[model samples]
Target: MKDTAKHQGLRNQLVSLLEQKGITDKNVLEAIKKIPRHLFLNSSFEDYAYQDKAFPIGAGQTISQPYTVAFQSQLLEVKKEHKILEIGTGSGYQTAVLCAMGAKVYTVERQIELFKKTSVLFRKLGIRPKYFASGDGYKGLELHAPYDSILVTAGAPIIPKPLMAQLKIGGRLVIPLGEDVQIMTLLIRKNETQFEKHEFGEFRFVPLLEDKN
Candidate 1:
């Protein structure tokens, strides 16, 4: 529960590394700095929690690598109070970053084990999302649809159509698209029937699962 001076120093180093890697969004960087990343990891991993790498959480899901979280977050262009839909909650590290930016986040997790663990984590950290669900993220959180932005944390074979339908006009969806390897794809909603697409380089992520838990 304690974020000591050593942890802060390591976080500073991580932020510096990210800046050198071309992450220019200050808000995303600051959120990464402020969040106690170690708190989201297992006791065995606490020592290297700020090293910008992914570590297994539980239920076969990995807390997203720090650089990946920052990259997708910057692409999402979070605005204060902007409604955000996060497809995978994992250890809730990324959700905490969104909360730090004052975004109203609706996060869904497919693994029930992770959902329960991370729900308790939110209480301990005093972070809250607008909604949290332990269900298939492929369906998206339809009850709270039309988000200003949607962020998919896992690698998908193709963009989920439900997620596209839930994005508000002029909003963006940041997702990694592929099977064994992924290309970071950003889709911007232009109108009801049109979207602008862009692809960045490759990334590796746990596959986004459907109904199977």
Candidate 2:
């Protein structure tokens, strides 16, 4: 529960490594540095939490590698109080990162096992996302539609249509598109009917399951 001086020191080192890897967003880096990632993992994994690698949390999901988390967060260009929709809550590390950045996050998780576990963890950690749902990620939360940003943490076969339609104009949708290995894709909503697409290399992520309930 306590983030020690050693933990902060390791996080600072992680930020330095991310900078070397071309991460330029200071806010993203700061958020990463502030989040106590070890608390999101198994106690045995506490030693490896700050490394630039992903570690399995439980179920089939992994707490995303620090670099990937920072990269997606940087791509979104989050501003204070921006309404962000997170498609995969996973370990709630990414959720905490967005919350730490002052974004009002509405996060959905399909794995009921994980959703149940993480929802409790969020309160214990004092991280309050704007909303939390245990259901399909493909169907964006319509009640909270028109988001300022949408971040999909898992690999998707295609951009989920409902998510795109729910985006506010000028909002950024950052998702990875693929089966085994996903290509990070960014869609900036230009208007009601169109989105500007850009692909940024490749990343590996657990598949974003459609319906598991």
State the C-alpha lDDT per candidate.
0.95, 0.95
For candidate 2, the 10 contiguous residues with the lowest summed lDDT are 204-213
Query: How high is each candidate's TM-score?
Result: 0.98, 0.98
The residue-level lDDT of candidate 2 at 134 comes to 89
| Residue range 52-97, candidate 1, lDDT tens digits | 7999998998998899999999999999999999999999999999
Runs in model 1 with CA error above 4 Å? none
RMSD (Å) of each candidate, 1 decimal? 0.9, 0.9
lDDT of 1: 0.95
Q: Model 2, 1-213: lDDT tens per residue?
A: 779999999999999999999999989999999999999998999999999999998898999999999999999999999999999999999999999998999999998899999988898998999999887999989998889999999999989999999999999999999999999999999998999999999999999998845
For model 1, name the residue pairs that clash: none
